[model samples]
Target: MPRTALIVIDMLNTYTHEDAEALVPSVHEALPGIAALLKLARASESPVVYVNDNFGEWRSHHGEILRAALQGRHPDLVEPVAPDENALFVVKARHSIFFETPLAYLLGQLGAERLVLCGQVTEQCVLYSALDAHIRHFDVVVAADAVAHIDAQLAEAALRMMSRNMSAAICSADGITFDARRAD
Candidate 1:
């Protein structure tokens, strides 16, 4: 059986970037789904990994980042999907979670052969992360409703690329099942 992991990417953002305002609505819509998936991931004994952007804070830790984001422009986005004590946290400097991070090693340690990706900027970070996961030979299952984007059109295109080129399974968050007995 394939071991599955949930990767929540870049949702701890401050939303202070140039394109942040435009993406707020979509991010708001995705919050509930992300939260629900987080609950499901925890209940099933599956690993819940948060791959967050460090935002150039060399000295920043996960708790510091979470606190900052909670006090940042949009706390609603960060607060709902905040990482818990049991969730594994990996800070990344770039778009891909595997870039400059120990994500691959952590996944290896957890024996995660399949990944359920959920988070912000569907056209950018989420897309790149999915590609990297695919290249690493991991089965990718993107929680479509749990991902937000800056541009709707580009986000759609990115989803298509993930489905066509990378063979990622795109489905709603509620449809995602982490049951260990079933084949992913």
Candidate 2:
């Protein structure tokens, strides 16, 4: 049986960017769902991969990156869905998690055929990552309520594109089932 991996994208944020003002509220709304998904993934012993932006801090590793985000203005946003010790961490410099990253190789090594995606910037990182995941032939599932966005309209359009163009499963976080024995 193929394993299901939970991909948490760009959730480790500092909230110091120019668009942070517009993005924070959306993150607030999406937090509970993201948190719930994390809990479920962890409980099920499924692979939990956190693909986060490096924020131009090229010198930082995963722990340093996480530390910086936690020390940022909105630590509240980073706390709930923070990566646990067992979670896999991938630092990305661009929007798509797979771009110039070892995520594809890592996923293949873990035997993750189905990916449950959740996290911030729904129209940007999440959207692009979904497309990349689609082309890679991984079964993509986007937790609608678990993704945050900078623009509501663009986010909705992105979700539509993922569903229509990429054939990604768009559903609530609660709608997801994590059993590796059951095909999604």
Candidate 3:
């Protein structure tokens, strides 16, 4: 086995905020499971990648994003939680994280052969990332409970497609355990 990473996409509370313009129910419920995966990644020392969109705006850097999300008034459109020092943030302009981001290079440097993708909008970014990882010959695991979509039916269907069509392992967050020694 090779190195693995825990990818949490768009878990920002901004998307889940009670007054978010784009709030989705599936993502809201995904928080607990996302939290569980976050805990696991932190506990296991596995690298955590946050694939967040620039909200098609901001026109800012990562630091500015943090500032706006955490301190900007006017109900900023971002989750107000600070990421850990080791956690890496990738701001994506398109729906796909791998489209033009450093994600490929980061994963290569991390020696990550398996990417555990869990986050919001099962049919969009999360789906794109998972499929990209699989096509790239990376082991892709999609945590069912840790991800959500506005349409539960589509989310469920997407999971099936990922598992049966793309060879993704759809497991629960609690069932996942990262082995650092295995990375060696």
Residue pairs with clashing backbones, model 2: none
Q: Write down the lDDT of every candidate, Cα atoms only.
A: 0.91, 0.93, 0.74
lDDT (Cα, tens digit) per residue for candidate 3, span 1-184:
5577998776553343433444455555676787788888888788888877765566766666665555533233235224677889888877677888898899898888888998777887778888888888899998898887866677788889899878999999898877563434
> Which model, 2 or 3, shows the larger lDDT?
2
The per-prediction tally of clashing pairs is 0, 0, 2
TM-score of every candidate: 0.96, 0.96, 0.84
Put down candidate 2 lDDT per residue, 15-109, tens digits, no spaces: 99999999999999999999999888888888999999888989999999999999998999999988999999999999999999999999998
Which residue ranges in model 2 land beyond 4 Å of their true spot?
180-184
Ranking by lDDT: 2, 1, 3
Q: Positional deviation of 177 in candidate 2, in angstroms? A: 1.1
- Compared with the true structure, model 3 gives a TM-score of 0.84
Q: Give one digit per residue, the lDDT tens place, for model 1 in 15-85.
A: 88899999999999889889999999999879999998878899999999898899899997888889888
* lDDT, residue 5, candidate 1: 95
